[model samples]
Target: MAFDPDAKLSDVLAGGYDLNNRLQALLISRPLDSRGQEAAMAFSQELSRVFMLSLSMLNSNAVAPEVRSGNSSGVSAPAKDKRARSDNGEVVTPSKKSREEGVTRKEITPSPHKDGYQWRKYGQKKIQNCSFSRYYFKCNRHRRCEAKKKVQQQDGGRGRLPPMFKVTYVNEHTCHELRAHDDAAARMASPWTASRHHALDGVVDTARGGGGLFDLLPHIVGGGSAEENEAMVSCLAAVVSGSVPSPPPRSSGWPAAPEASASDPAASFVPPAAAGRSASVADDGAMMMVDDTGVSWDPWWSFCPVEEAAGHQLVTNQNHHRDMHMDDAGGFADAVWPEHACGAWRRA
Candidate 1:
């Protein structure tokens, strides 16, 4: 390859068939009307200028696209010229997982909840390979609220559309209160959201990890069992009591609970009516009578902060940053509303 020392850096970058060059071309080379050429060129130059400035400040440790060139091997080039497979075979798909490591793609399905804003469904789109229809909702509360949500039907595994769904909220809305209201309104609009509430009345359980985002598909298609129901109740109780199962004791001079080596009768007082009190609590909590017959199950572990228990399996650590939207209006108002002993609580 011949080098052109006097050429602009933008021209040099775009001349090579590498990821960086491809990206620059895609972002800067949009089709413009004949009269719009000057405006487009100015915009492209500005974007390139910004990119150059940012590149100078970044360390080599930053993840930038690896550049490569390919001759006519008859293989079609990737459609979007943004990213390419690295020489070391790193493939970057712009959907779903790009949200990992601090890059936010606003095009994803938005979170189902917003803090206090309301919205109404204005359209629905049928995307291929998506089992459920995508329902679109725009903020009905404030013109200032430019938030939208896409609701997709979750596949119900047995060739059916589960009464559950995956809701994505694409929000750039400034009105935090309206955002919250829109979140609550979305829940009210979706029938799948309603089913989750109904399911919880008999059995409410979920799992989560570091981020507040959860995968709820597991329980959606899989029907609940008697043992699962009992587990659900126990899990809820754990959260309420503020004691996630004390992580299995680590080896060391870990002190066990102090016991009565009782020469003193006062240290170990026996309750005269312990049996009656325990029964009454159980009776009150076990109102939704589903049969516990012929169901055997294995126990599973998850982290559920009482604060973040509205959705599925989630693990909690102080370092984990929950979505600001989740905290905006007490996540999933439908699930948390009218707090009663729905099931046992599990706390992480």
Candidate 2:
């Protein structure tokens, strides 16, 4: 069969347009890995170069002479017609030339190039004082494709860092299979798959609306009375709001001590002889506790220190009267009431 140049060029142009549309769709809709994304971008850039070259060829062959003659005619035609022709021809030529120049500059500039495409290794050469060999590769997608590249490592940079590779391209690719392969690889390595796996690990079953804080609290705090749970929640709310709830009146037969203002540092201080006694404070910044034993407790831990007046606001609205107990050994231990309640209270 005889080859027709026009027919072949038309076919190539049609195929390029179709491929460009498909690439744009994939870029928008499909998730891609880093390598695949790089390949897609590089392929897009190459396609743009081809489109620009075609435009330049068409403009030069079809529009240049007519424009030049009109400009040389020296006002022979109407001003509007000449202006319109000049706008179409003269303005476009310089812009196209500048764009082509920019693309050429980018191609020659030395930089790290890792446009993902399958390349077959063809040769390796060792350079003087270099720790690595330079590897040469050719595009293997088509036998006719002349695209080739050389990758070489920069000397003297090493440990814990990525080795610098200088890549040089010799020709453009004729094979179009690189874009399809890149799209496939990108789909396979989509980040959504990893995120879905993570979501499945500890994600609450929120579809049923049952994973609320109150629902989870029973499992976390163990078994407890309803009253104790209510108290625990209220105390937690107060603590979270940066307020300390006042202790109930001393109804457990413990003796009361002298009252003092919260501003005074001496109010929270316990003498070495009187550490075993329980301490309390009045509503108006007064400390009232009587020391019963000589065993001294760290006053800072025993009571909400009077010095922390900003945090120790009395919760007068709370009607629940629960007794507070301090262990003989000075650490928080079992309460005279519910043991589970004490545990919950401590946790709050």
Candidate 3:
């Protein structure tokens, strides 16, 4: 469980802290065990995803869904899940990246400064013999928030990757920002999640009494293009039928955090079918659990940008672990765990 992202965060963190804990079960390192060569790296990546998600949710400056131009009504699209807007009004949905920089830089960032909280740079200094300067930041609300951070540049990974940073933090935050973020995150989790109660009356009425899955397609896909909706629905039907198969591996994985390209058909997403799918789930309700396997890669998984981005980047691993994850590992190799795995009514 230590290495599995699907486990509870508390469990993962606790297990990681143990000198020899359950996580070691995943470590099969042997003299020439080629299979286990990337185990350590995979563990690190999953752990990084957890840390990134947890910290990012705390960012007060986190970006909200960008309202695409055209909807003159200024009314938000029905599907809050999507990141891009199609001309006819559809976009592939995913947990959006924090446009806050770092991760969004070239869709891959060298900076790790996009933690959940808000900060303001107060000072920067050049070290005696360092090529990169040492910068400092304090909580955005310095008077009420006492947290401070020092970030120093690290060696570029032999130029294979960009420069990394050594970040040090002092003092705990008094901003109570986490609570605020929690509320916002819950709000964004999903409006159409499946739940028995806490569901919107209109949405619920529309679903159980409405047409079959086809009728529900547009609502779930967020109302953009027919192709987008059909593609999403096709995947959903396959998932519901138990045999859920892994998508064929692409030479290059889809962008973990993609910018909307109005010109691209694949990038176009339909409006959310919240009414059809989210019959009742409004917030933190029971997730659509198919198996107790601990990881759920249900249809909703595709729409969650946060989990989707972090999880898919695991493909960057040399072992092609992601391609094998669903059959051997969890499709996501784990999930948002409690955050997403348990979310959506919220996580999706």
Give per-residue CA lDDT, model 1, range 15-118, as digits (tens).
33133333344444566566456654654565565454334432232332311121122122444655534325787654554333222122211123221223
- How do the residues 168-229 of candidate 2 rate in per-residue lDDT, one tens digit apiece? 55556654454345435665799555444323111222211244554455444432323223
Worst 10 residues of 3 by lDDT: 339-348
Q: What order do candidates take by lDDT, descending?
A: 3, 2, 1
For candidate 3, give the lDDT. 0.36
* Candidate 3 global TM-score: 0.23
* Candidate closer to the true structure by lDDT (higher is better), 1 or 3: 3
Clashing pairs in 2: 257-289, 257-290, 260-287, 273-294
Deviation in Å, model 1, residue 237 alpha carbon: 13
> Candidate 1: global Cα-lDDT?
0.32
Off-target runs (Cα >4 Å) in candidate 1 are 1-117, 156-166, 176-348
Per-model TM-score versus the true fold: 0.23, 0.21, 0.23
Tell me which of candidates 2 and 3 scores higher on TM-score. Answer: 3
Worst 10 residues of 1 by lDDT: 255-264
Task: Please identify model 3 stretches exceeding 4 Å from their true place.
Answer: 1-109, 177-348
Provide the RMSD of all predictions against the true structure, rounded to 1 decimal.
Answer: 28.0, 36.4, 21.8
